[model samples]
Target chain A: MAGLTKQEGLSSPVSVSGLSYAYPAARGGNSRLALNHLSFDVSAGEMFGVLGPNGGGKSTLFKILATLLRPGSGRVRLFGQDTQAARGTRKRMGVVFQNPSLDLRLTCEENLLYQGRLYGLSGRDLARRVDDALGLYRLEDRRRDWAGSLSGGLRRRLELAKGLIHDPDLLLLDEPTVGLDPGARKELWDHLGRIRGSRKITILLTTHLMDEAERCDRLMLLHEGRLTAEGTPEVLKGEIGGDVITLETEQPDTLLAGVRERFQAEAARLGEHVRIERKQGHSFIPQLVEAFPGLIRSVHLSKPTLEDVFIHHTGRGFWNEGAQQESRGT
Target chain B: MRAIAALWSRELLRFFRDRARVVGALAPPVVFWFLIGSGLGNAFKMPGAAAGVDFLQYFFSGTLVLIVLFTSVFATISIIEDRREGFLQAVLVAPITRLSIVLGKVLGAATVGLIQGSFFLVLTPLSGIDLPLQGFLWAATAMALASLGLTGLGFCIAWKMDSTQGFHAVMNLFLIPMWMLSGALFPHSTAPGWLRFVMSANPVSYAVSALQHSFGMGSVALASLPLCLLVLTGFSVATLGACVWLARDQD
Candidate 1:
């Protein structure tokens, strides 16, 4: 453990500087940029999240860090060593891909054993590590069972166990809870928290779920291959400095103009909803209702959330925009 | 070395666990041997000097080569599956070198090919091919080398493909023809001038010639025993080298 900290003298666990990546043109389509001059640093033993929607370049970032894809430009350093030049860096990190990497036909124990050997673990040490992983993931009873036969949650646990078998100091997971149910997702988070507490490992995960992002110690919000915001959930939400108010109206543009002209408040129309971010939102609701008595169909006000922070920075509803982009096949 | 051993064992574990894959690889060649060998018996004759040598006996050696080919191709197809399902990504990121990954997979696939090819050896007596003690050893050695070469070739192809459909296309267009022209269907001496040229150049021809010489069933020698072994070894090394090169990066 002390030797592991030797590289931790004066550097963050993970750092990216001026990183950019572009996907090559496929067939007749033009090449698309996946990441753009992104830079961030993750402290040792911190749980960090890259929060984004589909095609937001989080996956590309994950690949570059995992050393699966070379960065198109710039550099990524893990534990003060450039990832491109450091083969030893790979030995110190555990990566869990978005898709399940388990060999479905093999038993839980066999999968871990094989993974352990990939890191040069063997003899009694490998056996003990495999046993410990099975026990820690609560997979002892199912050690002999085929991985494909396990329930979805158990299989995910086995994946985590395999990733941890070599006892990597840094763990990277890409969309770890994509297909998991709420209960399983929570359980997975709980396990992650426990692992961090016990081992002091640096855990970096990417997720599109706002609730999942809220659980991170720190998060960077990505949109269209750019970082929109970076901070703890509280700090990010706090940047709004007030409540978020939404007014449902049939004529959103008209109400938006009226609110801007009459009250001189900054308001934007998003679909059928006119949104305003302001301080003292509760008191403003009455003034808003009085100004437009028959026009305002409904009014909703709430404290700032991660989504509100996203909308404040990007000026678009997260889910709706994501859905629209997906439908258009962008 | 340890990584190679681990990956090799993993391949064996997965192959044995999937009963369907094991049966699928072994059963086809046996069926083809009995049906094609018996159906085309004595009706077929060679252009060279050997007479009264039944096609069943001649095709028995071909069936052995087919077993090796089918088993190797089917075994290496798992590489495509592993890539699509994300297993290859895990291996690619591991601390092991690409050479170890290639060696492990090629050896694993070769072992499957060897086991299936050896299983076909038990039926050689039924085809009336007498195997002397020394000849059986030579034949087994030839079978193993052929298996390694074929499996390495399959690995090279599978590593580049993302879809099983693409692999199937390569199998039909490239692998099957390679086998057909390797003196598996007919002797090189009987082939036309153009086809004879192809048979002589095919690496698989050396493997088939080695097997025929070991079995003492054919007088036609496209290449000598030492030359055949050298070519087969070169074939294995070249294909394995190609796999290592292709697997050096993940794009």
Candidate 2:
């Protein structure tokens, strides 16, 4: 099957700078900005991950790239063509939305055929392309099955295949694997990894999973519509510059006050534990042990994680949603 | 042409797939053709009306027009489903021209409308209404054009509406009243003056009137000819234009 020629490589990195957006909401008849000067660049052929809490504008940014929602004020270029223009920009990109887009009534093969024909392919050419996509996604066996009848993982894989059916240069995925079992999620990730190796399809995926974010070549941490940090996973962890000292104590508040007073250390609480950032965890342990001897039942020293990196950068967990104070109380 | 064929084929495939949908598309025209035609055929008072003609003969056009109207309006459900399922987005992102996309689906749905409208043509003889070969051809042409017009209107409405409930409500508010006022099931002379004006302005009324004329019924309303033809032509252009405009920004 003939796909887009490699000689037609991506032009340059997608760039967005000084972009601001706001949704009009009636609150005493007032509107608020959802995003403020959100600027970030995605280099071509790189797996770029955007990590953020729920309602933190991650999906909003994805929508902007997908061209589903217009940014109130911003410049968005796809392969250097203005997205708002619609004609030249669409040929370069493929988008798989968060909502399921597959036609459940049609068989998987038929759905792909219909989508391919929309892009001006037909007869033998269309059939060959469909076969290629089906084989690539490992869905050749179940190509005759209805899309709605497939498991969530299979459906998601099909969605990816459908999006790529036109052989687009860029793939924009909005929470593609939002709800899948662990085994299925792992399997889907493997398929994703395989595709990335085979094709230079530039992928920009929005994910809330810390582990998934760590797998990306580069990660952008977005907090409340703002870019807090951008770098490789290791570099992001290195930015924190210290080991994490976690204190598991029954009386965390009392122990925290005493530790602050004696050791002059600040800590962030997570459930029943308090994670403190310190240069030397081993050296600080004895001092902490002596001061809060009985209260500090156990002390664990761990390397900084992507979750920790996000927390350090955004001062919040990746799963945290600001509106639910009661949820955070847990 | 290929895009239109693909879209139209998809609609036909979808229409035949659901048993209930097919039955729903055919039921109204068939039932109304018999009931209203029989009632009016017995009580009609037009002195110079064709002899041996049952009310079903005069009502056949209206019933067929109803089929076109119902099929066109309900086909909007496909749009809602496509939007909900994300299938529409897949089509929108393709490299084909946007007008082909709208034209394809509209023509596809209209094919079903034409088929259902033609079904009533078969029952016309059974309803005691004479069906000549020329009558069938003319009526078929009228139904096809009316279905095309209605499908175009449906496509335009579906483009702007995102929710199924809203789509249904608009269909009910816009189409149901227009169908009732169009002299489809009843004679326009019996309707109130305001309704007569509405029927005069209604494109469906002209469509049904044109179909009725094809069946060798009463004199053609000359004043309505230009008005109906203009609305049909103008709305098709305007709605299609709107569809193309909306299609461009489809991310």
lDDT, candidates in the order shown = 0.86, 0.76
Candidate 2 Cα outliers beyond 4 Å, as residue runs: A1-10, A27-29, A249-257, A269-273, A321-330, B1-4, B43-53, B128-134, B220-231, B242-251
Question: Which 10 residues in a row give candidate 1 chain B its minimum summed lDDT?
Answer: B42-51
Candidate 2 A-chain TM-score: 0.89
Off by over 4 Å in 1: A1-10, A321-330
Docking quality (DockQ) for each candidate: 0.77, 0.57
Q: Give lDDT tens digits, candidate 1, residues B183-240.
A: 8767788778999998999998988889888889648657888898899999999998
lDDT of candidate 2 over A1-330, digit per residue (tens): 012322455445466777777888887776767677888777778889988777778877887777667777878777776667655677677888888888899999988988777666789988899999999888999988888789899998898888888787788888878888898889888988988888877888898888889889898988888888899999999986588888898976677667666766656655566667788788988888887768987899989998888777655555663221211111
At residue B116, give the lDDT of candidate 2: 75
In model 1, pairs of residues that clash are none
Model 1 TM-score on a 0 to 1 scale = 0.95
Please give the lDDT score at residue B112 for candidate 2: 88
**Model 1 misses residue A30 by how many Å?**
1.9
Worst 10 residues of 2 chain B by lDDT: B218-227
Candidate 1 per-residue lDDT, tens place, A278-311, comes to 8899999999999998899999999999988887
Please give, as one word, the docking class of candidate 1.
medium
Candidate 1 chain A, run of 10 with poorest lDDT: A321-330
